[model samples]
Target: MSESDFTVRSVPMLLSRNKSQEWRDIVLLRSGMLMRFLKTHNLLINVEPFDENGNVKDDLVIKKSHLTDDGLELFKKVIPGWSQYLDKGGDVNNINRLIKGLEKIRNQ
Candidate 1:
């Protein structure tokens, strides 16, 4: 109803923080309730913790970057300006804007 209602202290967060059944139970219970409130009466804001990437996307995921070194070398012939940013620690996620909708295609 108000901003104060969405504060962390107002939430029923599970105390457990591990890869176990207890954690899974907490997520399942909370996520379901959150969805029902949204779909039924449009009652509450969907502030659930699970993210667009399932709250499990690791940027350092072994193959998260579809751009391989060899691919970049060949791509350099096209957009050479990307190297200036990429070489300076620019994130590939940031470059996805240049990709229109091709970003998801590459990730798969």
Candidate 2:
């Protein structure tokens, strides 16, 4: 998917002033789901871990967009069965696929 297709919008909250913190929390909570979706589409470019304060924690980066053949092979190995559960089509299948994929990933 393109970056534009994945854009997240902000909503005004009457009771919350810490929008940055809220965004970080939301991202942290949904990171796994986002990773799964990216893997399914073979579009995962990089994964950077961060602390609660949004500080980068590690230097390990996987830029699939710039990967060579060997790098792609390694990435595939690292993310085995990445899109194995993504073939189901309709709305029901889509929901089932997501639930099953999340359960499998969480279990692992």
Candidate 3:
């Protein structure tokens, strides 16, 4: 798909009325067929913090990062069309677009 096809819009992420809400740009990475996989699996992107000595911290956090070799392979197998987008550290612009699209879809 072309870049124009991946345009994203901004959306609000709010939790409570008394608290301040965070806003971020959103994009849609996958739709239609891929949605089923997402619904079935509780996949997590694990990130362990490390100190200057390269030792992992005690607290592990769920965070986003570039996919590992195994992760890339699995992702490609699941969504071939989107595999390219995950390469080269992924397209930040397109990711933003995807998030927005997802937000729109969720609201609908």
Candidate 4:
């Protein structure tokens, strides 16, 4: 599959099933799924196993356009409120506050 086709297939799988509280895990899972899909379609380049330290042995050289398109589509579906929560970066205190605020609104 082409990058676009891989992206289309992967995003829905990610958006439909994730319950991770960590934003980093969410992104990693999305990226890993996309990479796996690309590999399955024989579209990825220089596939390598992770090292003992759990780092990729080689760099993944994908175009920014493909990455941007895939990430934007995935986030749009999986985390509609992600930007509102992550706009300030690693603001878990604010995430807590925001959740409480939404709870208050919901209880009204």
Candidate 5:
């Protein structure tokens, strides 16, 4: 996809009413499909929004990095080609499987 195909919109990441954080939200769409695609191909850290109707929205937050040093080594040992994805980001379902994968890599 061309650069236009990937849109990084800057929005305020609020820490609280008085404090905030800065981050970029990357979104990819072609023919109306939104995948969290990153050049680094790392596992994405995602945030989902639930509507008042109890339906989940497509909104997600994609961090630029995935995998801690130990996790990276573990992943590389177990899953070949894991490093490419670690250095990038892509969409995978947000579920227990993902949670478990991240749990292993998360900082202690």
Candidate 6:
């Protein structure tokens, strides 16, 4: 049920639900909480487990875009090669990705 759970799908709800700012706040909080819980259980989806080439493995759980800054920070602590994957001099693509990821999390 993790894939279809309300906490996983935020923009559109299959069930009738409140749309107030207060409700949205609660939803965001719950979503964060859910991610934390999943992380501890090793059930969260995302790019972890680098391949032999030191890149992300072919697997996913929670998406990076859906994560809050705190969530990403927490998740990063668990990954082995997160730093190696980032920080190329002229190639600021990963930097931009980090910024966008953080912004999207904060905006939510």
Report the candidate with higher TM-score, 2 versus 6. Answer: 6
Local error of candidate 4 at 48, Å?
Answer: 3.8
Model 5: which ten-residue window has the lowest total lDDT? 23-32
> What are the Cα lDDT values of the candidates?
0.35, 0.38, 0.32, 0.41, 0.31, 0.41
Clashes of 4: 0
Worst 10 residues of 6 by lDDT: 86-95
Candidate 4 residue-wise lDDT, 1-108, digit = tens: 544423333333444466655644655443454454434434444433234565332333343244343333333343345335555464423334334433444455
Mind sharing the TM-score for model 4?
0.30
Clashing pairs in 4: none
The clash count of every prediction, one per candidate, is 0, 0, 12, 0, 7, 3
Position 29, candidate 1: lDDT:
45
Pairs with backbone N, CA or C atoms under 3 Å apart (clashes), candidate 6:
45-61, 45-62, 46-61
Error of 5 at 7 (Å): 5.9
The list of candidate 5 runs beyond 4 A from truth reads 1-48, 58-94
lDDT of 4: 0.41
Candidate 2 residue-wise lDDT at 107: 57
lDDT of 3 by residue, 42-72 (tens): 2323432334554333232222232333333
Q: Please write out the lDDT profile of model 6 over residues 12-51, one tens digit for every residue.
A: 3411277577655544443343333444444445434334
What's model 3's TM-score?
0.21
**TM-scores for every candidate against the unseen true structure:** 0.25, 0.24, 0.21, 0.30, 0.23, 0.30
lDDT of 2 at 62: 38
Global lDDT for candidate 6? 0.41
Candidate 3 C-alpha error for residue 80, in Å? 1.3
